[model samples]
Target: MLDTYFNFLQNIERTLGGGRGVKYGLPSTLQKVIALFRVDAAEIRLNQPILAELRLPSQFGDFNRITSETPYTEAVITGAEGHLGTLVLYGSRQWSDNELRVVHLIAQQLGVALENATYFAQMKLKTSELKWIDKFGDSLLNMLSSLQIQEVAGRIMSATKDLLEVEEASIMLKDYESGDLMLWSHTPPEKDLSIRLKPGQGIAGWVVEYGKTAIVNDVKKDPRWEPAIDEKGGFDTRSIIAVPIILDDEIIGVIEGINKVNDIFDESDAQLLRTIAKWSAIGVGNANTYEALKHTTEQLADAKKQTAMAHMVLNLAHKINNSVGAVRVWAMEMADELKATPHPSMEMRLMVENVLHNAEETLLMVRRIRGATELRPGDIRPIEVIEAMETALQFSRVDAAVKVERHYEDGIPRVGADAERLVEVFLHLMNNATDVMNGRGTLTLTCRRAQNGTVEIMIQDDGQGIPDHLRSKIFDPFVTSKSDGLGLGLWMVKLYVELIGGKISVTSTVGKGTIFRITLPPWEK
Candidate 1:
């Protein structure tokens, strides 16, 4: 293993001078060891990025920091000269102690060598700056692609630390509404730095407040730079550089790199930092816009649906009114014909009188229909559960065909929903159950007090149950097990229940029966 490490070091030198820098490349011995243990996350972060970019394997890809609490196994090794870097094996689960020891040694040697390479390469301006700029750009792009904003910020923070050769790094974002700057991401406390600053309160805040970049070559001499490292993170503040993240003339956030490792940050460092900050601003703006548009579009679609349903109700009322008018005309004609035929039989005469009476009643119902509307905020009030169930049964015409059973708990609490809407739901469910019975089986409606201060309604039918395969998608729009169904009834019922902050569920046993349970928050008794 010793000989292999020595040889690999020689190969790294040769590769850096002759080929492109890669981030990870393993020696034959390390490769064999990694393969034997089935280690999927073998990584190499060479100290000398130039050598790393040339010698490291491309398969390992890039490394970034995390915003959330990500559990990982990490080992840090210091060289003879006290040079520091890290070897992180992230993800959960432990490796053998023997393998861990070797990993630590390998990571130390790799970090030291890379560090040496970077120290020597810093003398060259163009090559070092170009490489760091490319790395920073790649890190920003990765953050933009991430689903979580904090994770992306974490990655950018760590990458900035590496590229700037700084001891600590952080990203602070502004809350426009609160006018506060918050620590969005930072290296863990164990990583040798602790720094926290409020927006417009500390050096981080100054950058956001002024919308400009600030560089303190020496922290001791700066007045705006507060030395509260002990109060915040328990570390000394020496040198600091902060840059604002500006988007569309507004300062959205700031990124700061603290304590340069070797030299004070120069114009080259500032150039690279500003370039990264520009790209980051663009990514953040796009994400914010997308989230806002999604919320607005959803609300607009809901409004349109309610409007369309209201229009349907109006049209239905008009049709019913016209039918009632025709019935009134027919009854008047029958009365006139009966009166003109004075010798008519008693049965015929009585039938004519009955028809006239029914017509008058039907006209009164038509007037009521014109005034009746869908249950809305103003139309809803506390109503008795059993009474609503009975009304629904009458509307569904189920009582005439199916055997009806009603189980009501005395003093069952009222619910906070539209009484008419509840009736509509009961009617839909009862009619479905009746159809399942095909005019033979029993239809049961039960209302009772529930354990959670809510009312429970169960509609059960002793008929062929819904198929198992269809149950999973039963609430989805346009999914129906019925042959003649429009497939919207169950979907609409679920939507209405959810809108009212209630729940509905179904359970069925094949060849036995199906039961639907609905629970709603109760109104005051």
Candidate 2:
């Protein structure tokens, strides 16, 4: 009977292979054994507190003594070397003498078989861990090849959850200056676990602060764990294991796993978690460095562009100044000659009037150029949308030729944007529409409130719509469909719109006209 029972335990391990080996293997065979013993239920409780089954033990009839009122019988049977063992039986009546002998025989062999099965399980677990590590190593290599920090961190969290076989996993980054740990990435609760930790607070923070791994076998009992996130997440935590992500002696982040599948996390989980932490640290460091370099490069480029623009502006101002001075002198000379003559011919008077008008226009043009160039970021004002549109249309001198329609929402709040830039934006759009219409089509300027508390300004044209392929490049610098277009008009308009924290988008279909929408944050009225 002992040999037969040993064989039954051995076969049970083989029956429950793969991921189910740890869960479905023992309880099932143990149930059959309970039936054989005529007990209502049977269980194999390993290391206490892990109860697999529960029932009144009075039906088995396999115990010689009953010590507790529960009427359960428990025995300790040793293996080849007196190893720790457990066998419990309960029943209503004593078994037959032969049956009792068979029970003892089965108990003795059960101890040896359970020991072997447990050892086999440990080996299989180790093998599965190795396979996981290999897969993780391959994935790490691929992520490294791409040099994407967030993607690598995301993958690391995912791998940590899978390798640790936990309910959830997350990676938290440490801010050394603020001493705060921020949640970076995580395998969501559905995939693994969901947890958030602050610096020097939860397991993740403690690991980051100390630059070491910390294991909490039961999170519910750990005082270091907080209930801060429980209200929002609506889930109770059971266990946690956090490993510090360190790179070059600097603590960067923490990788954490929550709720092990069968039991508390062991050495294998610690080992894999540490490995992932190390690689994730490297990936995070690379990402930070890349971002820093990118920011620096952008600053340098902007500085250089500003320097070049300053030089161009100075040169342009010098040329304009000289030309304006010469035109002013010519206009004064013509006025003087008109006054000196007794009756300056009608043609001469008309010529002098034209000269004065052209001089005033040139000076105004110079002033407008200077104003456009001098405006900077953060200079915003509240200009009525209808008023700005009317001003731009009047300046364009197309109100007579083109049908200018203004649709302004009453009580619309003002927009926090530079008035000059906004005018330029409207002017560009209106000018482009006028050109498209050959100065004869209807141009509508509509204003309304946007979904995000921003003001939406739409400038629609009734002329031929932009081609689908050309719409994308319409705002690009030096890309224009018009033969006489400077191309910088729309480009400058886009720059000013974006500079004032506004967004511009165009939607057009062939033969249906085009609409340009500009959205700007509404100002406090």
| Whole-model Cα lDDT of every candidate shown, in order | 0.65, 0.64
Query: Scored by Cα lDDT, where does model 2 land?
Result: 0.64
What TM-score does model 1 achieve against the real structure?
0.34
RMSD of each: 24.4, 30.1
Candidate 1 local lDDT, 421-517, one digit each (tens): 7788899899889888887789988999876678899999999999899887787655797877756578678767766668999999989999999
Clashes of each: 14, 7
- List the candidate 1 regions with Cα displacement exceeding 4 Å: 1-145, 189-199, 286-525
Shift of residue 94 alpha carbon in model 1, Å: 56
